[model samples]
Target chain A: MEPLLSCENVSFSYENTAVIKNLSFHVNSGDYLCIVGENGSGKSTLTKGLLGLKAPAEGKIIRGSDLHGNEIGYLPQQNPAQKDFPASVFEVVLSGRLNSRRFRPFYSKEDKKIARENLKKLGIEDLIKRSYRDLSGGQQQRVLLARALCAGSKLLFLDEPVTGLDPIVTEEMYKLILELNRKEKITIIMVSHDIKASVLYATHILHLNFDKSFFGRTEDYIKSPMGKYFFSE
Target chain B: MFNFAEMFQYSFMLRALIGGILISLCAALLGVSLVLKRYSMIGDGLSHVGFGALAIGSAANFSPLEFSIPIVILSAFFLLRISENSKIKGDAAIALISTSALAIGITAASLSGVNTDIDNYLFGSILSLSRSDLVICIIVFIVVMILFILFYNKIFAVTFDESFAKANGTRVGIYNMLIALLTALTIVIGMKLMGTLLISSLIIFPAIISMRICRRFKTVIIMSSIVSVVGFFAGLVISYNRSTPAGASVVLVNLAMLIVFYVIGTVSDKIKAKKFLKQ
Candidate 1:
């Protein structure tokens, strides 16, 4: 089968200053690819680049015919600005369907059904009427996940999904992601700073060590020099 | 000393009532996104730009609305671009542009001996809303209302998360420009009722007040419209009855509602906290 996404020597930059250089990888359907890197290593930028939020400063990115950016759900990092957003969980999730129904004045019933299905899947259906800002952190993340699910069909990209969560919540989130990849067979490309967790759950690993990057299947990555170094550390 | 029903007898009062309510609703609708995005002060900046355009239009013997509309729209677009591009950001950019525009307007008004007109524009006499002004307000208000409703979902998406919306194929730039243009038009129309310095209160007060009580976005929007309309009517009535200034009276009513809602929000929040702690 053709790869869902392929990058050929992609370089990302800000203000003409290159931050990521000559990165190449392919994400196949049903692959759980976890990208690990240090702070400011362009891990999040790579996700943005793949979603066409930012154009590559160099080289090309080829997406499969059915895999447009709009069809890829994305869960961005949490920020203070969205904390006070006066929206219900239902409205927030419903907005994720905006891309599907273009030029329509309001959300259709089908869109609401999708939103409700995602909320039920995330086990937050009961909280649908509650305000988004009033929810706890874990609850908010689940609502956001439901929103992202409403946006995409098969591909989901999460940027540091477990960041700022307690250890128990982090573990739960990882388990939830594992269930999505294993049971639902959704294609997952996740960016994470937690190297150990990424190695454990990912089918493939893309490690950006700044000086040298490594990308390979999980089994092969375990025996690689950089992998050995990370293990030893 | 004036009766509320008798005030409607005058044609100018009728014009003021209709024009004020329409402009209030438009301002309230746009205010939600602006307040959310922390760009609430853009209204003030654009109104100052309108004042400057008014002074220039007076000097050039052009209709103030025709002259100021384009200039204010242009300035709104510029503010959007500058806030995004430059390091100055939103509020500072607004301060910079508005102060300069105010200075230019004052100078132009002094030079052209239109300072008295400037005062009328600044303080905003409700009786000054002409028949042509009423007609223009109605047309502009209808266009803005229709466009706002049609693009409601798109605007919500953009306001909630712009980058995410862009990734989902929404043209964030174009929508931002559309919002700016609509806001500029509303500010210009509202100027005849609210004035330059006080006009932003019409845009800001409703949304913030609604947020204090309404938790859901749609509810907040609906409540904001209701608050704005009611406040305008109440302010007009009180001003007419007591012989006070229209713009200031309206803003004071909004202010009073905001405080009332804030107190209610705080008390309810305390109750919620107590319940959660007990659980």
Candidate 2:
């Protein structure tokens, strides 16, 4: 079967500084592909290109018209409070239900149901009533994760989703991600700075260096020069 | 002693009450979204821009609405365009547009000899307004309502995340422009009751006060409307009795309520923390 997402030779640059160069990757259905590179190695560019945030200067991305009707759910790195934003946790999470339907202004019963369920799944159900700006770093990360979950997407893309969380919370978040891909049958693509966590959770890995792009199963990549360089102690 | 029954019997006072309520509802609704998107200063900027536009309108013998929309639209178009680029920070961009528009407005009023009645623009005098002003208020209220309903999701989504909204099918530029245009138009109409200097207080004060108490987005809007309605009428009454500027009194009432809400928020936060600890 053809992959759910396929990018062909995607290249992008900002004014002449090439961020992504001749990059190509295909994300299979239910594949947990964790991408890693040194900072500014086009990891974010590829992620944005996948979501069509920045159009490629060179290639084509075929998401194939919403393969299952629900598309991508993305949780960017920035916290809602870091922006000093003024929305409650429930309000922010419910916003993720934007694509669910429109004729009504208020959140429907099903919308609340999905949000409550997602919060429960993420183990932060009690924080549903709290203000998003008032939460700590770890709690905010969980709330954001549940918000992304409320989108009811088949594929979830996270950009550095677990930065600043405590070690225990980080483990829980990564474990939750693994469960999302394995049991929920969702495709999870993320750019993680934690190489050890990437090795611990990712089913497959993509490594981009200044010259080459490498992609394979995680076990096979344990010895690749790019992988060793990234995961080196 | 002022007689309340006398003011109640007057047609002008009645229109002020009705127009004030409707306009309050419109501003309160849009204000919530504005606060969330971190574009609070746009309200102040557009209000000043409206003053300039109003000056031009009076000078050229045209309706303020007709003259104001184009100028505001032109400025809003540019502001929205520059926002996408990181060339200048957000507040700097807003400051640049706001100061320029304000300077031009002052210069236009001065040069045109258009009888720059500061009272009319600052504190809208009920005694001087004609039937046309009421009609304009009604039209503006309807326009705000229509815009709010027509692009509900698009507006909310844009406020939530600009990039994500663009990534989906929503046109961010059009929505941003629509918001700015409506804001500029609202400020122009708002100036009739509020005056140019104080109209932004009308947009933000209620939202800021209600935000301290409310947890829901829609609730904040509803609460803000209630706060605005109460403050506007109370100010009208006080201004009548005390002979103060109507615009300034209304703004003062809003500020007082904001302070009260601030105290309440602080006290409640402590009480909640105490209760949680005791548990």
Error in Å for residue A186 of model 2: 1.5
Model 2 interface RMSD, in angstroms? Answer: 2.9
Best by TM-score: 1
Task: Quote the positional error of residue B19 for candidate 2 in Å.
Answer: 2.1
Over B91-171, each residue of candidate 1 has an lDDT whose tens digit, in order, gives: 777888888988988888888874577887787889779999999889889988898899988888888888678778889
Q: What are the per-residue Cα lDDT tens digits for candidate 2 across B80-197? A: 6666567878678778777777777667777877574644864566564557777878888999888787777567668867765554545678888888777766777777788877
Model 2: lDDT to the true structure: 0.77
lDDT of 2 by residue, A93-186 (tens): 8777866664566678998899888888878888888876678777877777777777646888888888877888778788888998999898
Runs in model 2 with CA error above 4 Å?
A: A64-70, A79-88, A102-108, B114-119, B122-124, B149-154
Clashing pairs in 1: none
| TM-score (chain A only) for the predictions, listed in order | 0.95, 0.90
Docking class of 2: acceptable
For candidate 2, the TM-score is: 0.92
Q: Residue A91 error for model 1, in Å?
A: 0.6
User: Given candidate 2, what's the lDDT at residue B122?
Assistant: 49
